[model samples]
Target chain A: MSDLTLTPNIDGADDYYAELLAMHDGLSREESDALNARLVLVLSNHIGNRTVLSQALAAAALKPIK
Target chain B: MNQIFETPMYAYSRHADQDATTPPRHKVIVVGAGPVGLAAAIDLAQQGIEVVVIDDNDRVSTGSRAICFAKRPLEILDRLGCSAPMIDKGVLWNTGKVFFDKRQVYDFNLQEEGGHAFPAFINLQQYYLEKFLVDRVRELQAEGAPIDIRGRNKVSAVGTHPNHVTIEIDTPEGSYNLEADWLIACDGANSPLRAMLGKDFVGRVFEDNFLIADVVMEADFPSERWFWFDPPFNKGQSALLHKQPDGVWRIDLQLGWDIDKDHEKKPENVIPRLKAMLGDDVEFELEWVSIYTFQCRRMEQFRHNRVIFAGDAAHQVSPFGARGANSGLQDTDNLCWKLKLVINGDAPESLLDSYNTERVWGADENIQNSSRSTDFITPKSGMSRVLRDAVLDLSEKFEFARPLVNSGRLSVPCTYDGSPLNSADALDGPDRSRPGSACPDAPLTEGFLLPKLAGKFTLLTIDADAPDVIEEDGITVTRLALSLKNDPTLALKNRYLGEATSGVYLIRPDQHVAARRPSFDDKLFRAAIRRATGKE
Candidate 1:
């Protein structure tokens, strides 16, 4: 059984996002773009399992096309 | 071990007042006789303006400063009448192969499309480039062009007024004061004039420093760019190898932050490092070695009252993408035309505002690209490093990920997209010749489209009869025609007249597309020229 819940696991996601934006306060558009790419990759590698990673990727794409 | 370059002295410093014919005021006085200043002088002289350029040094750049000359710069240099020598002396390389560790990650080529005049990239020493430009300037001067280049004359103080600038210059002979209706500072990154003006270059200064070495050797290496991230010889760091003319190989090795530059640049240390990458089998001589810390920075504006800035004095970037000198060449290309128009009362003085705006956009783009390339080569933090490694690893296996790889996104002409100067394209024409973009050069029956356009507002009509040269409101527009007969491969037609077919384009003197319309309407074309000329 896979332990990937796809639920909001972090206690204070809002606080984290606020901190993220704050960290990105003075960064240029290019810097912000690089930061985001890195964040996604780094966070993904921390999650680290093939089945769990596939599940997360599929879940992320479940939203209606914007 | 310490091999210094032997530079020929052009003109020694002379007493400023020694010229009994010294005018109280010149049309434009350029500070710094480097490539940028010399190019600007030539452009201004072509417009029939008097220019006096003074430099602190009496020779060209000591080292091979900017080695990679991009195509757009070559075209601008062509107009200034000095591209042939560069092309002939340069090692033209259109392909670049990137590697990760011991494996070749991805390779890219710029020659996927041909038929244009110049190659995609030419690796030539900046010294030769400057020398050729200076020779052209001197030749034009001998032919009665009013461009004066004075060496060993340094600007000690700068005084800016509403209409003019007064500069105090210190020469070998003595000190003298000169006046200019307009002054351009091409004094390079460590510009004294920029300091005198009290403008700070605001941007990030990278922590890492790169050890640059130009070694001369008769090796059988092909003309190609070789870049490696964490190569075996230089473990955990990046290495770049580029070919230069005269059997010189320019090698740049990344030295991490907190490097003792003097210790590393010593020939004994540098030779061992070179031997590490290049086997002892190769007989190489150390030519020049220096350590540089890259900074992607620029002034908020390139124009300040009567003093405008072009090239390194206005902006600076890392040597990664080779945009440093290439973008400066573009600055002269962009500024000279507008300056000419304003000086001759052909365009409003407000036109100079576009130079500040457009070049700021250009500088931002260069800075962005340069910073990104630097980050990719030497990531900032742990997470960024992880992602960069992933990008490099994935680049080899997948075609999609290959585009994500940033091995110095080499220099390209900046399109003035979203520029207000553009007359919106109501007509659907080819995407290649979009308004506010540098028009693609095509081989015509004669030579090329760029040489044909030649320093004038051109109404380039394709597959249609061109209207006569229209001169109105202090603007003279030339009509240039191209048809299926002239271009056998349909390259020009395909490039300029795309979907919905034949169109007329309003081209600026700098060969940037001002506007494009599918239908031949004289009024719309003239209006485009007016907008491009800053009359609105």
Candidate 2:
């Protein structure tokens, strides 16, 4: 019963995905993981709605039916 | 060698005081003839006060020490009649680019809106700055200004008194003693004057060293500040490149905390680093090489009885933001006007306390900003570095994260908010020119607004009627009226009288807004002048 926009929310989706990968290019394994964690925190702070965040977390954790 | 540093400009010369039977008393004695001390001496002399400047050394600073001069200090220098040569010889630029790991993250333009006289910033060698100031001092002296700069004369001991201060000087002949009604210490961070008085600064010492190399024969680089974070040339560190006058380029490389001081400063060792960064094809000669480790610190109080402290003698900050000499100039600019009023007896001695209050506030602002820039540049902890890198990474693609990059937030004018000198603010105008703020310069029909407000208390009115001059308790306040008809561009209205149809501003001698109102009020303006001069 959550009203969260989950379909095509980002423009230039491929570019953002490529940049997300490029961000960890020269960093070590631990540094890349730290960066990902920090990026998650930064984005979470940007999107401060707890209800939407909770829904996004649930959706990200769910698996596709095989 | 650069002739400015090599040739002694003010060599040791015996003054009449040295040969006198009784030690001659001076109105004001400024210790240290560096840029700050020279500026203090110049300001005090220009105000008809007899001032003497003493220094251990005889020449301007070497190695092109402080290169970046910000707008506010430039404005102050303009008032002192020394900005013409500085602007003529300085490399003016407002654009700065920040690069992260070989790719540019973002670029910024400090594009101050048009109509101001000076640019946002200029890069001129410190030697040139000091030399120009010395030249001005000479010009003032030629015009019979009561100013004397005694070189190779050092102050070894200082005795503070209730009404005056006794200074013991050291020269080749012998030690001599003199007294002064007031003493100003601009003797730099390692101020011997501060030590003689058992005073000290209390702040943080940053654990980082930056290698500065002033190289001649620079390549075709744009006249802009280019800063790099964790570039390949120096992995896990930062670098800065700036264009200076005379085809010289200043390059700073971050060498971590625990490095050999002497070994790293060698030309043989430094050239390798430079070659690595410059790709070995470029031809450049190292004009000067220096390693500097900075601290963000300041004294508990600038005023100590009859002796006062200004510039590095009072406070210091890391060199990241070019705040050292810049803020030192501002310190004198804030102090000299108040000191002049106090010395002239137009205002009470309590007026000098406003100098301590306002400049201490200014020093704290510089220290805080430079400290933050130091932290951002050299992250202490692993998590901090991670967070810094994350911000830089995000800044590459995200416009919102660009503001997070702090490669030295350049120095700006400090607004003395909540100052005791400030009267109530009632003008419905822009906050940038509010009470206790530096007056933002705008173009007048003739020349500029700042030149008109030079070295006096002014009542500025825009479309508002006010008297030509007002005298309150022996202090004089003159009027500078401007109308909307003359301001065709509306720069004045936009900067000072925003939204309001008319405005009146009471400006301090140091070009700071003392108070503002919607329209002219006789009693209010008179009372504000009294308060500004510390009569209240």
Candidate 3:
């Protein structure tokens, strides 16, 4: 399954992503997978950037589940 | 028995010199070293889980943003072994005075009803609160608690993966990356993380801006909260005076619907307004003055993937009631414990989803209440203002109008009613049986407090009829003959458990009742715990 990425073009984008990553760390493998499954669904629902969401999904796939 | 050698405290110490470079990676990373973030970090660390806290600021801000501390936060701090210092430093206020055109209309004492461990509210500066938390973090670390605090290092980027989260940071030295198992965003209203998640923060932004001025004054104002409904200072403006420790006072002045934003910072502009509110005869220098805008909004969801939002990032409430920071701290309290359980494998992954469900619902309620209060205080249209004025005028004379006048609303703790963690059967019974309510505080003999019996799953049975209900797990079962008498003014007593008999209540670590049953059953108790931890 693919993951999702969220990239904000506004100011403080890095800080925002850092917080998201921190939150992701708290999730379980199953929960993380479920989140990854819904990554496109959830990000597409809020942000209109398809490219960013695709990149985020690729990033999610790169990191193997612990 | 052989005598054991008493090891000195120093012998147990983990020396800082032993390679600070390869610090153990934590399960969770909490951003913002404020009260809420620190509380979450400490709670998880106390549970024998690793936590790392990062903040960009080197030192805590001395500004008195949130001066009021509620009882629930006090309880949470107590769990972290840090409440004593806070209780010792804060000024407890149980009475408040409401004024109309500089005339005292009604005086209410929060202590008139007293089932709570703390007074309805405690006034302490945010800086002191942060300091107490920092000190505790250090103390816990020294005791071998798994908590790492990195100050002056701002989070630069977050890359969330299926397994872990890589958090890039910009330190004074250079940029670095640290991977954490999970991340909790406890950052304030301008949460940088929330924006990246693509969550929409939707709500009304009040047009009226306020001037918050903190000053040291030698005046005759009593040690009571004073709120002027409609004062002549700014004309059609509201002013509030809250007494702080060591003769300092925090004054909030509503600067009308529109004013030059730039002029608010000028001492000349601010001093005149302060003089008008405090009377020209009162001598006080303007220590700090800044304009503030109130917004009643909430994030669509508190969680997305591995990232969860807490405090101001999740929601924004008007300062009319001191609900902003208090609610944020409560959010942290709720999320941290559940995260601990899931990370520790004591509960299933589904338990983490409850954080989103419960907190989002609570955020909605807080937003509604704060929005209503804001509408009442500052009516948008002329017709709304006129209606509010009429209600205020009637409230003075008509005894029936007192309820509307007093605004029964205060920033008390909120209960979660419809959470998935609550039992479906308990939903239809009395309010006491419902999950997501704050546990009722009751007096116990031996100077012991009852709410202290909470913080973990508690099976509180009012009678010996359920003697065998006690389990040796994380739950503590309190068997009592009858419900203890509680003070009327406390919301927990009046709102949740109104003289209930022989019922079982499950309290979450955040002190909110996760579930309740008419009788103690092992199945229900297990289900309640499972639901609270999101394992269900």
Model 3's number of clashes is 20
**Which candidate would rank higher by lDDT, 1 or 3?**
1
State which candidate has the highest lDDT.
2
Query: Each prediction's DockQ?
Result: 0.05, 0.06, 0.01
Chain B TM (all candidates): 0.96, 0.98, 0.88
Off by over 4 Å in 3: A1-66, B1-25, B102-104, B406-408, B425-433, B465-501
lDDT of each: 0.83, 0.87, 0.68
Top model number, TM-score: 2
Q: How well is each residue in B328-438 modelled by candidate 2, as lDDT tens digits?
A: 999999999988888888889988888899999999988877876777788865555766786687666555456666788778899999899999899878999999899
Q: What's the distance in Å from true for residue B380, model 2?
A: 0.4
In candidate 1 the C-alpha lDDT for residue A66 amounts to: 19
Lowest lDDT sum, 10 consecutive residues, model 1 chain B, at B1-10
Candidate 1, B1-536: lDDT as tens digits = 32223564457646445464553688999998888999999999988889988898878887788999988999999898999999899997777899999999888776546778988778988988888988898898899999888888889999989999988888777777888999999999999999999987988999988899888886788878889999998888899999998889999999898778889988988998888888889899888888999789999889998999999999999988899889999999999999998998988999999999888999999987887778778877655566578667756654545555666777989989887789997667777678878988888887888898878888888876667688868988888877768986677877887665677888898899998877678777777778998987
**Which wins on TM-score, candidate 1 or candidate 2?**
2
Cα displacement (angstroms), candidate 2, residue B344, comes to 1.3
Error of 1 at B93 (Å): 1.9
